[model samples]
Target: MSQFSFLQSEFAPVYEHALKAESAALSDPRAACFYARLALETAVKWMYERDRALKSPYDTALSALIHEPSFRNVVGNALVTKARIIKDHGNRAVHDTRPVAQQAAVTALRELFHFSYWLVRTYAKGAKPEAGLQFSADALPKTAQVEATTLARLQALAKSFEEKTKAHEQAEAARLQTEQARAQLEAEIKLLQDEIAAVKKANQAAPDTHNYNEEQTRDAFIDLLLHEAGWPLDQARDREYPVRGMPNNAGEGFVDYVLWGDDGKPLALVEAKRTKRDARVGQQQAKLYADCLEKEFGRRPVIFYSNGYEHWIWDDAGYPPRGVQGFLKKDELMLLHQRRTGRKSLSATDVDSTIVERFYQTRAIRRIGEAFENDNQRKALLVMATGSGKTRTVIALIDQLMRANWVKRALFLADRVALVNQAAGAFKTHLPHVAPVNLITDRQAEGRVYVSTYPTMVGLIDDVQNGVRRFGPGHFDLIVIDEAHRSVYRKYRAIFEYFDSFLVGLTATPKDEVDRDTYSLFDLERGVPTDSYELDEAVTDGFLVPPKAVSVPLKFQREGIKYDDLSDDEKEAWDALEWSDDGQIPDRVDASAVNKWLFNADTVDKVL
Candidate 1:
């Protein structure tokens, strides 16, 4: 049964001290009769609510208990026996006109002490909520105030939780209502946009320099949208697109604009929102219409809707909705236009920040190339934020290496063991190789320009002890490490230094005081010929990926885990760790450690 844990913070001390006091002062000739009477009173309370009708009142306490229903609450036969004995003791001392012996009284007090002890033990063992929590049963006047405080606190917390839940439900309802309204407005906006577009297209197809109006502007925009979207605007005007449906495939659904791209044979279904707020907006409706038109034309139409005013684009219909994009006028487009959505030309500063600027103004390509100038020490470490394009960084580096041939062998190492294998596998897929690439695992330990676990080579020292081990030092030109703050990161440092290889470590987390050894790789102050290098140049050059730093705070129910200051047992384990003849721990020590023989009787099972 599930147990509700009561804190030792409140009731335990009172229980302990009260039991001690009772143990001390409660022993006297008269006390035996008092206890007996108390026991009889309890047994009688059981009689009033007869869940199981008793066969006879005179029956032994065992008979009454065994026949009782709530075995969980009352301890059946055993408790009944205790009650009977106490009643007998009371009769012998109090009512029989006999002087109670001191020993008899002391024995009775001792029994009371044991009963309290039993209650404590049962509580400590934990019990079900259905059984109810027992606290302050023997409460003194002094302790009642504190118990009341604890109860009050619990009540407040429950009330707070209920209030928060109710507030959240109300907020969610409001949000849902808001979303429905926005969708309705967006659809109305789309309809106005579509009508305007059809008008412009008619004028364009008509080949007349007609008087321009809102209708003409709309038609022009639709025609231009179709052309750019890769749909043949001329063909679309004549209803040339094909249509199909899923459940009912009788050409029920038509496609909009379907176009061929250099790669994706890319198809887009568009919904246009002409304005942010509009009545009866079915902008998506027109986009959907175009999508259907494309399907009818035997191609998936890249759908688009534009009001020549408000521009909202969706790639597909399935959404919250999804593929939602708002119109943002670029510097080229904003040279003259002025509105909340359209602004003046992008300033020189903004241009410098753009990705295109890195190629020209900042000489980003040149900066990357210069970092690789040194044959050995030219290894680079770039710190980019979370959203920063690390993939693009790797791609650019690969591109440089492939073109220049300054380096022969390249190995990319992700900080995670899982990522190491993943990256290597992904690399194999991305590149064309005449010879199969090697990544060491349990099955195979050797390969050209291998990617593998740091321990893969060291793990087999047992078999190697009797013979010569094959994998000594990898013959790679460059080794890059990702997520370098991990526990295994120190091992990589050892590899680059002792094994005489150029190293580059990459991480989303910057080096901090907590990880000094990790920071040693990218020593900022001295900037010596150490195995590490940090780049501020990439950011200056606009070549570095701009990252977003998002800090998500977590609140644990209790404080987070805090290990105690190192214990003697922990110190002993540290001292015991040693290399064997095989360069790994001896098998005996391994087995012993696995069993947790480091501590006590059950140590062996834990050591592993």
Candidate 2:
């Protein structure tokens, strides 16, 4: 006989279906729940037949069967409660359109199993019921108790999922509402643009001229360029932007207008002129304002200056300031900001490698150039041992930066006149196309490439500090320091601080005790150069000869010797030397006496 034979022929269908439900529980819990529901209904019907007085209508719900007094009195409230729970879950399984939750189904099935076990024991002819039986967890097997707890935990998870889904739907609705509001704002802006265009057309057609003042011109530009260009003129931009830079004769300065980005930082600046005045009238003021804003924003922004009629855009990274028909679209301005800030690093392909002579030199140029591009670093340090060709490597890097359009004009500084001349020679020979001006004699700071002695640069910085402001902060796109370990320290540091250019320091010994300050000046980590060719590596690569240490012990005493130890001939010579009145050796002492007193012929021969 089967192990479930206690579920007799009348209850066989309930037992068979319960077995199928158990088989499907893991892989297909929905099917298992449906089958479990069927088993519960069958068990309830079997109980109903046993007590004919507890007659349930043919269409009676599973809850009614459990609540019937005849059935309840026989099975007890505990068993009836389990039967009711199964009835509710089973109805959901068959009638609800939503798929049954695994936990819900598993929980209902667990309760049904316990109820079926009780029914089989109570109703089967050969079965025996334990006295005072109850459907409490303490009476269940360990595995069944554990599974019941797991089902409860899963039910909690399902509830959490439902809550999260509801939150997501609410967030999505809010997003759509925001988009609709944005669309309405855009439409209003479009209407404002049309009104401005109509006004401009009407003004041109009218015989009476409209002489708009500076403020009126400013307002017109705000409506025509900013509003029409989709900038929205919201909290992000500011008029009469307060900035402090190169002081005037009165020692006060501020920008006229500044454009701000969403990040609450300055993006660009506009220097407005009266409708009748030339836009170039404000260029010098705009340049000073740009320098001042760099302190607050950490990057110099795109520059624009305009009278009411003409607009001009300037990018220090690319070509000179030129007239544009109108302001660029807002998206184009953002892209220009990204490019100006060097958000992406340059690749090897971006560099012009033709001037680089060797593989290692090329590698150094690529790495340091990429580092500069990556961070838009203001200062970079490169250490190559003497004879390792630092000048050539730096030239290659500068060439690459210029070719990539990262640098427009460059300045090279050195401590001595000879070093400056040497650097100029190298630049002329290697980069023949680049005009290398001598800043010392020529008094010229303007050139694609300018070689200058540190003292000459000092004079220029003094002029700027005294308010003559000979060179603007953006005068040089890049500055290279040769023998940087010496030139960038002490009183010479002002030259570096005055310009807002990218600084590159080249040294033969960066990690030496005296050069540590130089390393720190370039912002290099301790003992690390941005690009390094160590003495040992240079020798290993055969760029330099390996130095050998040879020790030769000297027999002669370094300290002064007593006159008593001198030989007879030396003593005679020393005695013959004439003394002054104060007992000092006479300035008229003969060469023969001096040489003989210092060393005998035999001693001189031995040293030689």
Candidate 3:
């Protein structure tokens, strides 16, 4: 009688988890949310295994799996959004200790039901399930016993399954009977793939009748986002809150959501619109709500508006509304409120001398500060040549910004792992109080400054846990790009666009040598960067030593070496070496091939 009963046949594996999720809805809400996500993940992994069209991603993390291009193409936008909601809520249920509501569990089950319906309709090999089948809450188990399991245990179980799969494959390779079993499994997978393709082709010819319930999905997603940011939403007054002094004839309107401070005054107000509508449509409406709250409490609250997919935060008295990936945490919002009156001038702040005592480095930091505070520029590029203390200069700049209360958190991105480690060490040594975290080694470590390679940061950019992203748009107050060049701009420009943070690009290459696109990324002219210190200047000022070139003359390098000219021991050694796979050796070696194809210890030592 379970709404997920249809999964018992072909999707038996998923059925067990889905049934548990459905049964636990009224009893253990957290387990219900977690199991629902597990069921969806199982089904999706099943599809990837059997369906030829769905290619696997390099990283098999659930977030990466669902967001993979091929997977998205197969599921479409509606199912993708559903998967996101289930995954997000499930993440929250496991990661957060706060009690999850029964309604959240119910919403997860409903979304899972629709997702299961799609899977069976598209992939079921035997006679397809009835199109008329509908999910009913009444069909869910009224009372049922559930197991107590932790997220760690579930993850270990998943890992065990993977190990077993590998072991089974190895056994199949060794024994003929097991090999035959694997062959049969492969054949079944092929048949299922064909069936999936046929079903999709047939579905294309028919009228679409599936109901996505986008409006409800949108509201659920927004709620999960708020929940992730530490909003309990337990009280009846949290949503559709009543307020006075609207511009309407009634002189009042219900605010969509109001986040309250401990004193009962409003911390912030959110105005939510339908998913399809522009989030900006609620901007003026949110302003009105803020005005009403300020009148009532004698304190102006920060305003936010969203359509589930897009979110914006505006401290109207100080700054314009800007799009954000998610809502800020309570402490972050409180800090924002405090900063309205307490923030000091960034341009007036003195650069830390202990971090960077060089004259050019300090000047570069001052120029960047002016670009940010005076010019109101969001991005700045520093073109300092190699060995010119680019890393230390930025470290000093971050110290200044942090002291002036302009930045709370910062991210330093490097293109190479070695560079990430190197920069992290510099930051730790100079700004020890900030506590830098190297994401390359330990991603879960928490700190004020985060350091990562470009690829590592790209993988982490979309990571959401308990309905909140690990690296939201507003997560970092500043993002520093190391070795900013053409490759970074071409391959990882999305990282810059995704985080709504002040940016600083550091490069050893001069402006003229650097790519035009890299300059454009920092909103600078092709030959004019925010600041520059050429290698020639550094050398002239005695900050860096000029390179010295020396030429060494070697007999073998200048002329070719003939086999007959070698001494007895040298000839024996040459004959012993393998010149090619066929064991053939040339009669003579060319001058260009002295170091390229031939190596002599005595000659190399002499040259050195």
Candidate 4:
């Protein structure tokens, strides 16, 4: 008997996928994982279609659908986490080339079983599945001499199942053609909705009995992140790698994960901890593992410690430990290791004057370089007035950083699409050698420099492609915020927090003029910016023309029009005009109400 046999009666459409997932668990781990995710997706979509209480999300992607507020509210946090695991694993099974482990497939099946149980208990009108039922791997059918299928074949199989499911649903709907049958179905759906509501209320009051297994979740999350970073964990030496020279009696330890380079040297090592524990708790342990690897291989590997929620990277040979959003890719880690010995001093690098000729612009670049190179600060704020060549200045800064090997990829964010397009043009014009892509026009475009509006970038932050995020936390080495102000702080601050990159905020508004604490966003003190070129300075330097103010006065606007002061012709015209329904002309009109309530073309001509 299949572990998901309970779902066969009430959710036949979902049961098909669940049963296939169980059948392929041992024979084809990848297919099993893929089917588990398919089952969850089908079940969630089924609920959203039938449940009137659940609001449909604009995005139908599995990640977006499950993370939608209404879905999260119904399933709660624990179930949401389980759904995420299944979705992520299934995505990797289909999109990634690494072979899926049997253990991972088992994990996916267990999570799907619990998730299915919750769905059936809440929504099924027939016999509800028992909550005490457990998913037994031994009960899954063992197949001998199963045929190996390609990923493309698996996708085709899933597509076929979707077609069949659709046809079955249409046929079922055809049977309810009679008005009486349709009415009975509607009544049944209404009753089911009411029952679901009551169940939700009761579940809210009851204590949660689900075993979260946070440690397992943490390891799975870390695995997903590493895979996204291009680490193929197919080799036996990739995980739980044994090492010697520990201080304990056994004089040995097993590293959580080891990332290897083509030259047979360890590029980096990761130490994973439980989700609730601080990642720093493994810092010393990670350092010790690095020491052992260095003693064995003659080269120290970059040490990274993570608890799934937070990650930290420490290149003990070069820089202090710093927080990162995810693991660095193999090429990125290799380049980082190379930079330790080959990096040039940024202070010694010259600013490309051809790109930014202004003295203040060059000075601003120098101050920013000093902050990063000497002060060890990761954020810098540049306050310059509009039309002061902020775009050109940043292009030059990026040029210098790239030339010095400080930045490999950079992202520039603007509040408006027009600004994104304008900045992209500026980068292309000045730094023609480097490729620049405007995310506003084409999100899939690849380039060394990415330009995007804040809102567009926010949506793309969590967007996963081919089981990996297109813009991982460590994707960009630097991020430039154009027109950085209170507006960015209010609606799109997540963009800055999500990426593990050096931040350089460019703002036209002065500190005192902005209502929110803009300085705090850049980690700078109030009234102090990393560099400033005010409007007065720009005008004094002849970069901008000074403004001239003039005041205009009109007769009726300056003084209220008094009936006593009006000429006989004007008074006759006023009397001819209707001021109110009561047909009463006022003795005088206020200056503020002259054009608002009463308009005279002759008075407007005088102002013009």
> lDDT winner among the candidates?
4
lDDT of each: 0.39, 0.63, 0.83, 0.84
Q: Pick the candidate with the highest TM-score.
A: 3
- Candidate 2: residue 321 Cα off by (Å): 24
Q: Write the per-residue lDDT of candidate 2 for residues 556-592, one digit (tens) a residue.
A: 3343344666789977877676655666743234445
Which lDDT value does model 2 have at 310? 58
Q: Between 3 and 4, whose TM-score is larger?
A: 3
Where's the lowest-lDDT run of ten residues in candidate 4? 203-212
The clash count of every prediction, one per candidate, is 52, 0, 1, 0
User: Where is model 4 more than 4 Å wrong at Cα?
Assistant: 1-35, 38-61, 64-81, 93-105, 114-133, 141-201, 318-320, 439-446, 454-471, 485-495, 513-521, 525-528, 546-608
Tens-digit lDDT string for candidate 4 (159-201): 7966987798788789798999999988998897777677656
Query: Per-residue CA lDDT of candidate 3, range 1-608, in tens?
Result: 68887789989989999998988887777789888988998998888877788887655667768877788798876688789889877776776545677788888998899899888777765655566676666666667556555566655655676697679767867764576777887888889888878866775565547665777877887787787677878889889999899999999899898888888888899999987788899999899999998999989988999887678988887666777767777777777787777778976788888889899999998998888777777789999989999999999999998888888999999988999999989988999999999998999999999999988998887565654567766688899999887877776776887787889999888678888898888888889999999889999999899889998888988887999999999999889888999888988899988766456777677776
Q: Is candidate 2 or candidate 4 better by TM-score?
A: 4
Q: For candidate 1, lDDT tens digit of each residue in 4-56?
A: 12312222443333333233223334433444344334334323323222333
Off by over 4 Å in 2: 1-345, 348-351, 463-468, 510-514, 548-608
TM-score of 2: 0.40
